[model samples]
Target: MAKSFASQGDLTEKKITFDEVGPDLWAFTAEGDPNSGVIIGDDSVMVVEAQATPRLAEKVIERVRSVTDKPISHVVLTHYHAVRVLGASAYGADQIIMSDAARGMVAERGQEDWDSEFQRFPRLFEGYESIPGLTWPTTTFTDRMTVYLGKRRVDIMHLGRAHTAGDAVVHVPDGGVMFTGDIVEDHSACYCGDGYFGDWGTTLDAIAAYDVDAIAPGRGGALIGRDAVTRAIASTRDFVDSTYAPAARVAARGGSLKEAWDAVRAECDPKFRDYAIYEHCLPFNVARAYDEARGIAHPRIWTAARDLEMWDALQG
Candidate 1:
């Protein structure tokens, strides 16, 4: 039997939490769902990673209002995934910031991703009609951009490609906090369909070089200490390497995608089965690993139709 695409089969309402990990900084997390970070500067506020839809973002907004009444001055999009970028319009930000590569990703496959992700996860896109359209960043930076709110400074850096070609990290040196958007997850499946497995490890290494006190990952609970942060980053690296290594080797040896996926499943499932979204990510992760093994540098656009076709073939 074919399984449901992405997270559509998951219907349980998650318990949401807003935890202040540092001075004037909070993390909005819904169990293992996409997490957003809030930075309240002296004069304004910056939100990291928009939820999935406009209505969904309202929940995050309500939380933000409870803490500070400052207008949401800047919205930082860590990457261009539909689940992360579509709800940006609801923030009413003066400038939506992203890496130049992310802006290019929006231009290339944002619409297709919109259609693809909506079909895969209906619960995330609760008010699908409320989305004004594709979220576009008014400000684009290549390497890094500094955002100042009074004396507070939030540095957004394009830490090489990991989850996507445009993956960016939000670092607050003064706050000793870093918002790693999907680059590092604790007990959550790293969605590798659009990932660069090889480059991802190096990116994680660079992020680990920093003396981060806490981390607001794209998914999962906020890492509150240096040990917890170190563990989460290491786990993310392990998952990425364990999934890609076998698939790449199999593909090089004239093996098929199914064979590679089976190898990856046998290796990773026992260790990661209890992780969030592990079941949903397996098929896509293996597929991309196989493609990269075959020397496909870029990920193919995943559409709603293609999602089902891939599910029927892989899950059956």
Candidate 2:
């Protein structure tokens, strides 16, 4: 039987875990689903990566309310994926902050991405109708920006591109915690539909340079302690390297996309097939890898129609 598309087969509800990574930082992780980071300050709170919909984000809000009643004054978009954003309105934050590159992506393909991702991950967008519109960032920075929430420093830096052209990391220097959005997944597979495979390792290197005691990744659970954080970074690097290697080799040999994809599956599946979104991401990941192998510097935008066409081309 043919496999279900994207996360359509993943309908079972996962038990959500709200982990305290630092003094006032919380990571809302639901199994291998998209994760959100919460930083509670003395006067206000900042959230990184809004869930797919308003109803979905309410769970995060509920978790936030449990510990501190501080208003969510800021919401950060690590990237422009719909699942990681769309819920900004629900937070009622005074400002939605994102890297300028991310802001450009929002302007470029936010609508198509919203449609594409919503179709891809149905479970993640349970209350899709609740989303008001494209979540636009009110505040945008060039390379790096820092916010002060009652003396707490949260550095939002665009280290380099791994996941997208506009990927950013939330660093809490004082707490030794970093919220890495999809740049470094724990057990979950990396979604390379809009990824930069060639520069992903370099990006990982920059993130690893931080003195992180804990890491709240894009998916899976929070990596608590330095050892787990290190392992997550290493594992993420290994995963990226391993997945792109076969495809790159095949492309260098002037092989077809199918050949490259087959090799990628043969090599990556044994190790990453069981990981979260492994199957759903593999086709897109292979496509990007193949493009990168052929020396494509920037990633092409993924549209809803293109999603089905690519899926059929790969899986059929």
Candidate 3:
């Protein structure tokens, strides 16, 4: 039997976990779902990666309120994916920050992504109706920007392109912790539908250089030690390399997309078949890797219609 298109069959809700990874730093994670990070400064707070919708974002707010009453003053978007940015409104943060490249992506394909993702995975958009619209960052920096929450210093930097063209990492120097968005995942699969395949490994290298004590990744559990952090980064690199290598081999041989798909499945399945969102992300990852190997530097925008067409062609 054919698999469900994207995450349509993933209807069961996941249990959420709120854990402290560093000094006054928290990770709001659900089983394989998009995760958010909380940074409580001396005065207010900063949130990383808003959930898919306001209703889901409210859950993060509930977790935030559990530990600190400090107001959430800033919402930092690591990239421009709808699941990550659409909930920015829920925070009512005075400043919504993103990299300039990320903002450009928001303008280029934000609505298309929202449509495609909503059609692909219904569970994440629990309160889709409440989404105001495409989320726009109030402030955008080309490379790096630092925000102060009273005495605490949080450095947000566009280290390199991995998950998306404008991926950002939030580093807290005092605690040696980093909120690495989708750039580094723990047990979950990396969604490379909009990723930069050739640049991903280098980006991971830059992140590894930080030597962060802990990391709140894009999904799965938080990394609380240097060992866990190192392992997660290496595994993420392996996932990316594994996905791209076989797909690229097929593309280089002038093979069909289906051939590329089969190649990727053969290489990735044994290792990542049980990983979260593995099925949901496989087709897209293969497509992008194939494209990149064939000389397509930029990822194609995925509209709702395009999603269905690709799924049918690859998995039908």
Give per-model TM-scores: 0.98, 0.97, 0.98
Which 10-residue window of candidate 3 scores lowest in summed lDDT? 1-10
Model 3 clash pairs?
A: none
Top model number, lDDT: 3
Residue-wise C-alpha lDDT for candidate 1, range 55-134, written one tens digit per residue = 98999999999999999999999999999989999999999999999999999999999998887778888887999999
Estimate the TM-score for candidate 3.
0.98
Q: Rank the candidates by TM-score, best first.
A: 3, 1, 2
**Per-residue lDDT of model 3, residues 1-316, tens digit only:** 5556759889999999999998899999998999999999998999999989998999999999999999999999999998998988999899999999999999999999999999889899998999999999999999999999999999999999999999999999998999999999988999998999899999999999989899999998999999999999999999999999999899988998899999999999999898899999998999899989999999999999888788878965
Can you write out model 2's per-residue Cα lDDT over 87-201, one digit (the tens) per residue? 8889999999999999899999999998888777788898888999998899999899999999999999999999999999999998999999999998899998789887899
- In model 1, state the lDDT of residue 139: 98
RMSD of 1: 1.0
Superior by lDDT: candidate 1 or candidate 2 = 1
Q: Can you tell me which runs of candidate 3 are displaced by over 4 Å? A: 1-3
Considering lDDT, where higher is better, how would the candidates rank from best to worst?
A: 3, 1, 2
